[model samples]
Target: MNAPEPSAPGVRPEQEALFSTTAEHYARFRPGLPGPAVQLLAGTLAGRRAPVLLDLGTGTGQVPQALLAAVPRLAHVEAVDVNRAMLVQSRSVLGPLLGGRTLRLVHGSAHSYTAASGTDSVAPDLVTCCRSFHWMDRPAVLAMADRVAAPDATVAIMGDGSLWTHRAGWTRQLRELIQRHLGTARRAGPADAYTAPVRSYEEDLAASPWSDVAEHRCPVPRTWTPQGVVGYLRTTSFANAGLFPDSRHHDVFERDALTLLTALAEEDGPLVEQAEFRVLLARRPGGAR
Candidate 1:
């Protein structure tokens, strides 16, 4: 049977399939949350004895992995994602750290996932969606967070823009090369094309129940080699290897992309990708600003 089509605009059905097959590449090449970002998350739960966290769309469990490494007192984490393949990769990545603490891998989307209801159940002190909120129904997810979160809980929507959107000299040249090989239009899945987001994340958050929002910007410096850029591109929706019609097509694109990146890097030491990591914190009304 075929997969169901994505109902929402700006969501491509191919995303689910692409991520499922590229989980290994994602886990290997995707960057983790910066130290300051993790520290900010930890600071929010400073007074709690044993903080519990809910990571929505927790791809390969990167957010949880970083949090567990930084915040030793965190007692439990519920890593939720619709893709089971990503959860499998997450299990492998988080294997060593699961000794004393609890790491529950729940296979579900952000909007539908419910916390355990009994008195023994812990309310999440922090709910984080990193680089995955754009794919979700923001209002619905915020409503779910309102229902499941502790009174003082924080909902952090974090992302650094993708490789396709980055604006650097080398990145611009690389994009043009991709367009020349593929086409002028952006590709999503196999035949689907990419569409720009209609609404800003801030606009969606302000309309939700958790409307007390604050923004944090962290400059994360990254140096990417030609091979590293190619690896990362494979993990993105616009440039996933699976999107190509044939192996030959994918090989051609990869060869050209690498050659272009290498030529650009020859002028400089390595390609310095432009990235400003952003975290938008939304809290319940009347909570800390």
Candidate 2:
């Protein structure tokens, strides 16, 4: 029953600002969890009836939204995020699903959020952190999960590589074009830069309370048109339209990116992005951390 704290230590001001402004684009273009991944998480709760889920860094409620659609036994979801705009976008998209089930949207970081103080607040059967786990303090969040998770809870960390990391031929060309217009270096939020992780999520989880981890990967093939590629770029942190130096520059970049995609698609068919979506499940040992 502790009060929620301020932002966690891992939160960067620039990253927060970047995500806060791109809610609409994010909700529109970012892909949801794959069906197999959702099934794998839900499978961990086979006997639990009406399971409750705690989704940390629930950007636009994508994980919960997809789970609710896939897992009918889910009764409630506590969606937590630091960005208000992203939560707003979540509410807008998840409106219909909120009818019969309980969906509580909390404004807080993953390491600090808890269900509202009351006897009714249930310990979650599944704790999920989707693509937003990279932005969190892994140890702190895992410790927090240890405190709040149910005896048989499973902590699911899921993500697919972003467009920036994809190695498709057209994607490489597109990245080069972006670098030409912006700079050779990757652009993150204003005044912020991207760095490769010193430690992997697997390493971080291995050191946490939930160390008995199992990984599941699925091949998620995505096809995109030129316009779809442009839309997806606007949602990414590095290539967000807002990150451009000026409106004119943003427009020019978009135009050029579209042109590149169009040419690639003309030579081939729809630009297909081959991505592997991975989910790492860490369960509490013997019904306890």
Candidate 3:
């Protein structure tokens, strides 16, 4: 099927399929949830009975899985993504966890999701746009989120590995060199600043002037073997297929990534992949400003 016209501008066309087509690997290799982030979300949303949770851009349902595990009592979770492949992976992952009818998955873009139409008319108590937030038309997503969320509902935007800690000596510098040679479009080298912090969730929430808004940060330490590292990068929004049509570049990137990993291992290096996720939980303002 052809790509749908984006709900508006600013949405990347391939972002939808990039992770989806590689759904199995993504689900298999993507890092599992960090304890702090999940605990923070669970604590913030304590004591809600079967509240509806909307998982936006829920590729392979990792974030949703975490949410479900954290809030198993939810009435239902509605997970929407533009990738059917991703939805398939999600079903495989979330099928058993859901209590028969407690889970709903949709193939659609986050910008187009509407709580007042079709199967989503029931507003959600929480809407989460994990890692995929940057791929969205920010303005359009925020507007739609505002419309669909229940009063006092929370919107959480989260991405892991936004910060790269220099726990592994020489890794950061090596990454820079590799990234410099590969360029952004070329997937054939280390991703320098690949996981650098970009947008600030606090700023976004503050700018929106959301009522009862708060920001929380969690340090999620992750470990990956060399092969796992490669697979993990392949699952990224940046590493989407077709971005590097050049076979040579793709070959070189794989080679260099492995070489770097080997050297790190020789040095008895454990890649201390320190990542931080920020959650901007905001309730819809009551009665205007």
Best by TM-score: 2
Q: Write the per-residue lDDT of candidate 3 for residues 1-289, one digit (tens) a residue.
A: 1222224233345545455436778877777667777776676567776678888888888877887788767667788887777877888888877765466666677887754344345677778887777666666777787777777677777775421233455456445544554453424112222333366655555556354576777876766677776666567544433345476776677667777876786687776666666776676666221
Over the stretch 121-144, how does candidate 2's per-residue lDDT look in tens digits?
Answer: 889999999887887778889999
> Ten residues in a row with the worst lDDT in model 1?
1-10
Between candidates 2 and 3, which one is better according to TM-score? 2
**Model 1, 254: alpha-carbon shift in Å?**
1.1
- Runs of candidate 1 with Cα error greater than 4 angstroms are 1-15, 116-119
Clashing residue pairs in candidate 3, if any?
Answer: 50-75, 115-121, 188-253
* lDDT leaderboard ranking: 2, 1, 3
Q: Candidate 1 vs candidate 3: which has greater TM-score? A: 1
Of candidate 3, the 10-residue stretch with the lowest lDDT total is 1-10
Q: For model 3, what is the alpha-carbon lDDT of residue 240?
A: 35
- TM-score for each predicted model, relative to the true structure: 0.91, 0.92, 0.79
What is the lDDT, from 0 to 100, of the residue 18 in candidate 2? 70
What tens-digit string does per-residue lDDT give for candidate 1 at 1-289?
1121122233334545757556889877888888888888888888889999999988898898998888888999888877767888888888787668877777666788776445377989999999989777778889989999998899999999977789877888888887887788887666767776689988888889888888999999999989999999887777878777788999999999988888888976789976889998889888753
The lDDT of each candidate is 0.81, 0.82, 0.65
